[model samples]
Target: MSALIDRDEFPLLARAPELVYLDSAATTQKPRAVLDALRAYYEHDNANPHRGAYALSARATERYRAARERIARFFGLADADCAIFTRGTTEALNLVAASWGRANVGAGDEIVVSGAEHHANFVPWQQLALERGARFRICELAPDGRIDLDQLRAMLGPRTKVVAFHHVSNVLGTINPVREIAELAHGVGALAVCDGAQGAPHLPVAFDQLGVDFYALSGHKMLGPMGIGVLLGRREVLERMPPYMMGGDMIEFVHDDRSTWNVLPHKLEAGTPNVGDAVGLAAAAELLDAIGMDRVRAHEQALVRTAYERLSAIEGVHVYGPAPDARSGVVSFTVGDVHPHDLATILDARQVCIRAGHHCAQPLMRRLGVAATARASFYVYNDESDIDALVAGVRTAKELFGHATV
Candidate 1:
């Protein structure tokens, strides 16, 4: 483990000495800075925004807008107004499905999603397609758990209105070529929508560079507070799309008879928002920026490489996903004769927290021919000691399962 980052920088890790938090793919542990930000917001600025002209309200509104700017800059978006805040990645996807899909996708039009998408990314499109009489097509995954580019090319056509897929597989950990996929979607006259819930935190992402129509990411999974996510799209696209919700704040003019809606971001963010969570998310983004995304990527890649090598060395452990070079920070595997749930329990007993089960990617699990698997995901705070604990926990689990060593 490199001594680049001090344990004191992350209070959660510092306090929880026995806890090996390896489930970052699910939700990351909040850093001290983020928690402090959340505390400061609630303790001081507790006013509802965009309504009152009071000092508190103005401060709240300023904080909210600044959070948007922070997140927009983090993603390399051109305009902060283009980023709409939501509950989380699930809500972000649903907003796009309701707004963009309703306006653009119609009967006989096709929407393509990869088979490896989490249910958050899959069900919204599926439900929308059912509602609009649109054709829902899935891009097949290769044996190594990447999108089959040949099949993607064949499946896309003139009628394809939207291509929604994960930038990184939540289950397989396969990093999709966003630029290539976006270009392919454009070739078929389709809008490329990327589910960045799994990608944004681990990898450096540029919305403009990827040429994506929309990108969704969760705050909790990126060491920020829960209940806040971002949906970044082109200003033109969001301006044309209808609001997902209707209420005060998102209105231009209103009467008993009719009303006009607010502009880009406010239109989508209806009702009172998760202001504190958004502030925490901005702080988290700033922390990530300070560390530098390239360094973060390098640290995670090193952890993943170390994890893959160590886990693969253990007998009866079947690892999933592409090679370490092809994947990011996730490692999903199953041990022989031990149920994933059982393995998870044992690891938990050892204070080695890992995610088990389908990980909200049931379709991908079906493709992998498993009901569940144990997944260990690394993050910026993780080090080789964490990986060693995971490997040891798995070995102990296998031994408890009474498997013979080869």
Candidate 2:
């Protein structure tokens, strides 16, 4: 299948036609629609939300609310209040760890996470466990770079307070069975936390149906602007947790000694909201919804599989993760004796962009017995030509590195 949208739709890619952007896993190329939405927000509704009494401020507040509602509906969330605007997945996970984990987790309790988690997901929980005297249990990955379900099941018990894992592995592109993981956590009476920074962009996500207590996603990875993300939590769970922050609009009443908190989202969001970014993200969600995620997923899979096959056929190349059918559009690999940074530099020389280093997955890197790996990830604006450029650049890098990979 062809890509649902092409480079022409992305201003950056359209201007640099020769540049092959395979780093969507880090951040996607923003569509013109998203950029337009952002510009429109600033031009028309540029004001502080919630606290302002003026007309422009009122419009900004309404835009923020409407954006939240639209994004909630996009992700199958029934109540927009349950979706908290966050700086990014990092901040969202930290909020859960700081508020929910702090309140609920205790001594001897277990917090289970997979080896494949990004640092944002892994570190907060680990730190929480350490601070609370809880057991930070890590479920190591299977040989295929996915979390071992059997291992996870054994890790969960009555003492388990949380079972946190990634919906998609940023390093290996393995798509974990989120529903099954959530079910296993629920069986042990634990809350399921999902690091959905990667999965939400390439897959059709229904937050309510995914059976997770908290799901976090980044806007920049899904054709939206940076500085915007969402943490979709169950309403009941959110109500029980204390406010993650205080000040700004997240207040009901204030006194000299004590203060009452605001309701739902405002209770969690403590500062002036990023109305422009939220508007951009809502436009991105609408664009994706119109194009249909089913088609987007299929197109990405096709591109990644092509890259996987071509890369694997090279004698010195080693591809990580499960088969193409079992993962998203990310492909992490290494060429014999060629450092990932060096390979990335070579690729850059050819106007092909790919992510290098540990890919922010240092634990998984250690588990896979590597210091770093080169990653090529895709999105709707990516197509076969990008894959072709990537393969060619990689082949060139192998030759330059004295590997003769072909």
Candidate 3:
């Protein structure tokens, strides 16, 4: 994995030699391949796809369809048309809430979501339940921050319509058992929706193998650009739901009184799409595939192990989330007498970039009894030197705050 980072390939990392970027969970740094692919698409094939028949349009359509195929193949989906492009994970979840939830979930139905979900995953379902007169249920989190599977089983019943949860907790870094959870949802005759924003980039995600009805992911969280995300659903299930957004390109025909909708994927993707971002996302997925997810996961795991050991050794530092062996790359902690915002500012002076906020998981933060925490999350390019810089930064912050030890 060390060979994966060639200084020549990533000129930005070389340019900012002192910067230790540990915020991969928020968004990862793009590789040269993804950047070049975006550049090449805008330079050569800059045309609206699927509508025009000229040479440029033909090339654009080919590239767009190829991207769908690449993403579908990456997730081991049978049909590329099962995937739909959206703004990000937030929009993807909203689509599910508006389209599938509106159609399948009703007055007596129940929608179950985990307590540890990001606001993107939680609010959409909550809103849908409220509007449709459906019962909204929350699955409790265990002491270690993972979902309480026993509680989840007890909550699932005939009234349950959809079971929504994150594949990995953004704050806790607790990887959920998607296959088991999906089976449990199916046992209760409910659809399972997985928010894969955090999981897709760090681990190997095979949508079919996970047995989920719907899986949502963001491009930026991986190595792709912003404003692009994906929602992969089972073909038969998606076909049953009404279109979430109504506009051009999503319709087969329009009349004064009624309008007919387009086919599977197109029906879901409305209006002018984010073509360049989709191209960049495809390139990002290709880059990750080349590196191999297993290798990427292993690289990040080693970094997390080292970070956990070093941070835990500090006297006044309190680490959150699962133990080192039971976690992903995310490490959240608090320095004694220093607010997370202050700790972040101190760390930033040393060129150490870490996240300090609710991390979009305010409910989880409340559960942990902290308003915010300082988080250092790792990725493929992060190494031991990065962890060392973080350790040194924390020590400097402790000393600057007049703490004799830590």
Candidate 4:
């Protein structure tokens, strides 16, 4: 591990000294600082926000607002008013599909998404297109899982209403050129929506500089607790859309016949907010700030490049995606004649944790001509020894399956 990361800061990793956890692409383990934040919120400032006059509720409301501001600044936003809290990345993406997508995308209009998107970023747009009689076009990928930019350009036209994609691929680990994609969308007068669940955790993200109209990220993917995420939209764009859900906190004046919605963020946040998780996520942002995302990215890529090289040397192993230089920290591979589930099970016996199956990327699996591939992902706490354990486990799986190895 790099000097920037203290493994002891994460209670779960410190408790399981023998565990080789490489599934950070799914969710990262929470640090002690984040844990402490959650406990403090519940112990002292537990109350429903925005409706009460007591000191407890006031404190809760203030903490939630402060967290929103801190997180917005972390992501390079001008203010917290444009950012809305959601359950996670899935809900954030769905909120856009329900509101902005439905409002702007009409019959004969087109929605273009990359072939390498996770289902969270793919399904909603597809369903919206279907429901609204719009064309759902898939921009194909190159053989190495990189987006075919030429194909994407050819597909765009005056009818293109939205161009949605991931900042970093969950399966291929390819970091898509966000600013370039956003520019292309703008060239066609289409709105660009980015799923930042994979990018914000590993890279330094400036939301405005990316030029996207809207962006979404999950807290759990970046050392915060589960069930909390954010959706950031441009003020002008958000002001034009209707509320995603109609309920208590989202409304301003409710009458028997009709009701008016609240302001920018509260208009979309329909229910009681997740105050504790928000506080925890804010603490996570602080930790990442102190460690610096640049160092974190360098460390993980070095480990991944090493792992990719070592694994490719084995006789039965076939790694997928572009070269190590083009990828983030994830490596997906298949062992000869062994199912990914079986390989994952064997690795579990050695106290190793990795993700298997399509990784919520079934389309990409079909593109690769396989049903599934085993994935090992890295984070700040993972070191070279974890990659060694992964390689050894792959070799053992090959040996047990009667496959010859170098």
Candidate 5:
């Protein structure tokens, strides 16, 4: 596996050769390809894109436009103009809520969201409903941490203007039925929006096949640079919505009295733009395509399965989420009486990185009856050795906390 794609491609992994990184659900380590792309862009193509006619500016403009086209194709969106770049998933969700939600949703309208959503997907809609006097409804999670489709169906009504959810839960790693959810939302004349931050990194997503109105994803979680994300919406939907942010790039005409917004995507993306990181994100997408998303999903699935089995085998450890096939590449678990933070600290001492917190899904945490749980998420770079190291670290935590037996 290392021969296929060397771990040394990531500078941090090459430097700390012994680091077992298990927190990819937060952010992934970038490959050299992405790094070189960013550096090369700034070194050779540094200029304000789409605003100048000079040679350097034209080159930069082409690079920026190509990056958008590349990312749109990578996500299976045919019309590249529909892909809107933003800071990350949070900003993308806020864009939809602030622009589309505010325009379409009024008093007595309804917006439905799942219980397993990250704060990015949850807060914006909740606040949107509050501001619009619309009803904000949360669908409950199944016992296995998957979204309860039945409950969601019951929540949909004539007044439902939007239904938002995560394609995969950041904490539980549940892979949602996005196509079905989209269909359900459409059944009631509601637009379906998905938070694909976790999904795009681990699974193959076809926008047309899924039939969703809007999908949001972050670049940093998929081996790309930070401060970049994609908001994909249907062409008509994007064209119909108002501008998310008002500023320089997103304008078609400006006057002392009034201004007209730009095209489909540019109207959503405001300001100078993160041109270099956008180029880096395009490079990352190319690398992932070369690896084949199916293989990536398989690799993470195997690691997650091993992690679930080994972690759950511990004397008093409890793992959350559904069966191995039902979830993504994350495993959230609690050890005996040890706090998640303590367990994470012990693992960090062993040079193993893991995430420990409510994972920005405090509602799900409340449902699970725990303040937080230690999470170990896998990616293409992880292998069996990493999982073994994590299991050993958990056992060490039990021993240090005086709960080890046998």
Candidate 6:
């Protein structure tokens, strides 16, 4: 077994040494730096960020702005003001659908999305197209669970106003070709929107180089706190859109009859922002940058390779997605005749934590011809020991179910 990561940095892992945590695609365990940053914010710099005139408020505002800049830099975004804070990736995608989709997509227009999208990315565009009288088209996936680019190209036309797709499938762990996809959309004069919730956590994403108009990311998936995410958009596109939520912070001037909106990102962010979580996310980004995303990706890749090789050798274990090199750290599979939930419960008894069911990608599940799957996802903290534990737990489940080995 490979040596484990320094669990001491994450108190949860440190406390539970016996537990095997393989559900990182759902949410990662936070580092102490992130927790300390959150605590320090409330202890020292807790104030309404943009509206106050006092010292604490000024300090709070500075930190909040610094957090935004730090996150933007992490994603290789040139314009810091293009990073708009949202509750999470769900809210970020919704903001795009409501603000950009409403104005840009007219009757008879088309919004293209992939079947591999999480419900967060899928439902919003579908509903937005329904509301706007636009056609919501699904880009079919290849047999290997990748976006069928030929089909996507055939679907894109002059009426294709927007194209939305996940940079990495949360269920299949298939890494979509973002640059190529964005180029396809741009060729058709359609704006590309990438759901980066999975990609941001595990890959080094250069937003400027991706050629996408907008990318959505979540903090909690990247060793940060919950309730904080970012919608990094092109400044030109964002400036043309309307405010997502009309409220106190997003206003420039409040007339009794009509109120003007703020500039750039502030126009998109409404109400008191999640300042504390934003700080936490910044600290998380700092931690990732310090370690380097390339190293993190390599680490997860090693885990996936080890896990995939070992699990695929087992009888009746049908692993999904591309090979380890082509995918992220996630591995989804189903054992013969054993339900995913039942298998998950058995694994839990062995102190192995995994995810089960549709993983919020019901369309992908249906495409795979399965009701659900048992998924084991890796992160920096996971090692071969975790994979071994999961394998043993699966064997135990097979034994208990009286399944014969090949």
In model 1, where do residues sit more than 4 Å from their true spots? 404-406
| Local distance difference test, each candidate | 0.90, 0.93, 0.89, 0.91, 0.91, 0.93
Cα lDDT of model 6 by residue, 1-406, tens digit: 4533477889999999998999999999988899999999999999998888899999999999999999999999989999999989999999999998888898899999999899999999999899989999999998777899999999999999999999999998999999999999999999999999999999999999999999999999999999999999999999999998888789999988999999877889889988999999999999999989999999989999999999999998999999999999899999998899999999999999999999999988898899999999999888788888999999999999899643
- Candidate 3 lDDT by residue in tens digits, 1-406: 2534554455567688777889989998877888898899999998998788799988988888898899888878878999899999999999999999998889979999998999999999999999999999999888878889999999999999999999988887888999999999999999999999999998999988889999999999888998999999999899998999999889998999999999989999998778888899999899889889888788878888889999999989999989876778899999987888999999999999999999998878888899999999988777788898999999999989998544
Error of 6 at 94 (Å): 0.5
- 96-159 per-residue lDDT for model 4 (tens digits): 9999998999999999998889999999999999999999999999776777889999999999
Candidate 5 Cα errors over 4 Å, as ranges = 1-4, 404-406
Q: Estimate, for each residue in 119-158, the C-alpha lDDT of model 2 and write its tens digit.
A: 9999999999999999999999888778899889888899
Superposed model 4: Cα runs more than 4 Å off: 1-4, 404-406
Model 5 per-residue lDDT tens digits across residues 1-406:
2323577889888898899999999999989999999999999999998788799999998999999999999999999999899889989889999999989999999999988889999999999899989999999988877789999899899999999999999999999999999999999999999999999999998887888999999999999999999998899999899887899899999999999999877888888988999999999999999999998888888788888888888889999989988999999999988999999999999999999999999988998899999999988788888888999999899999888442
Please identify model 2 stretches exceeding 4 Å from their true place. 404-406
- Cα deviation at 77, candidate 5, in Å, is 0.4
Error of 2 at 129 (Å): 0.9
Q: Could you tell me the TM-score of candidate 5?
A: 0.98
The number of clashing residue pairs in model 3 is: 0
Worst 10 residues of 3 by lDDT: 1-10
Q: Return the TM-score for candidate 2, rounded to 2 decimals.
A: 0.98
Q: Write the per-residue lDDT of candidate 1 for residues 1-406, one digit (tens) a residue.
A: 7623566678978988888988989998888899999999999997999989899999999999999999999999979899999998899999999888898889999999998999999999999999999999998898778899999999999999999999998877899999899999999889899999999998999888989989999999998998999999988788888888998789999989988998878999889978899999999999999988888888888888999988898888889999998998899998986888999999999999999999999988888889999999988778888998999999899888788643
Tell me the deviation in Å of residue 90 in model 6.
0.6
Kindly report which residue stretches of model 6 are placed more than 4 angstroms away from their true locations once superposed: 1-5, 404-406
